[model samples]
Target: MAGQACLFCEIVKGERSAHVVMDAPDAVAFLDARPLFKGHTLLVPRDHYETLTDLPGEFLGPFFEHAQRLAGAMESVLGAAGSFVAMNNRVSQSVPHLHVHVVPRNRKDGLRGFFWPRQKYESDEEAADYAARLSGGLT
Candidate 1:
């Protein structure tokens, strides 16, 4: 069950909508609603974890294994040259959920250093299309 008032927990429990790309036993990967790039994805644990340190050690392997798959999908499924994977503890954690960001990258994609610039999908249909493609790549 989700922790009370946690946004990510709500998504995990199917109370909120997300463009889910991968739903594994340990983690769930979904497209970032406000993406740095179109295929940018966020992978979070099924349970609510406020930060990386809060995640139990037993879950580390499975959680990161899912992250690895999502990173690979950024290239294989999304046709990006590479991907950027990162996580913010409590300092910059927008939703306060333990989420790993897997952002698709290509040369001259306008991202520089650690400053992220957010963008939106042209429409919900477009976001769903990206989610479907990434889901297919993960399988």
Candidate 2:
């Protein structure tokens, strides 16, 4: 279940806003606001599950299925050479909501290590496009 005020919960209910990339009765995908790569995306269950252990077995199957589809789509659409999927739990997670990050990787991107430095946004327009392009793939 989701609380009415949770940011992700609002996105699930079609309230607030997000550039959603994929949606189903049980899961939804959207671009990560703070991305490590150009097309980084997040896939989350519509219901609130704080950790992997909290999720029912049935939900896990479809969630990963959708993640795979979205990862493939990102590779093709974003011209990414590879991708990484990760989920953080209580110790590492900043948000309690359960979600997975699907990040696109490219050989030429010049990322020296797993922890690449983040860049600052110069304009709102760029952010808006990032959201829209990711959301477009949801369909």
- Candidate 1 stretches with Cα past 4 Å from truth are 1-4
Candidate 1: residue 110 lDDT (0-100): 93
Candidate 2 TM-score versus the reference:
0.82
lDDT accuracy of residue 80 in candidate 2: 79
TM-scores of all models? 0.95, 0.82
Q: Please provide, for model 1 over 1-139, each residue's C-alpha lDDT reduced to its tens digit, 9 standing for 90 to 100.
A: 2435988887888899999998887788888999999989999999888889999999999888888888888889888999999999989789988999999999999999988799999999999999999999984
In candidate 2, which residue ranges exceed 4 Å CA deviation? 1-4, 108-114, 119-139
* Model 2: worst 10 consecutive residues (lDDT sum): 115-124
CA lDDT, every model vs. true structure: 0.90, 0.76
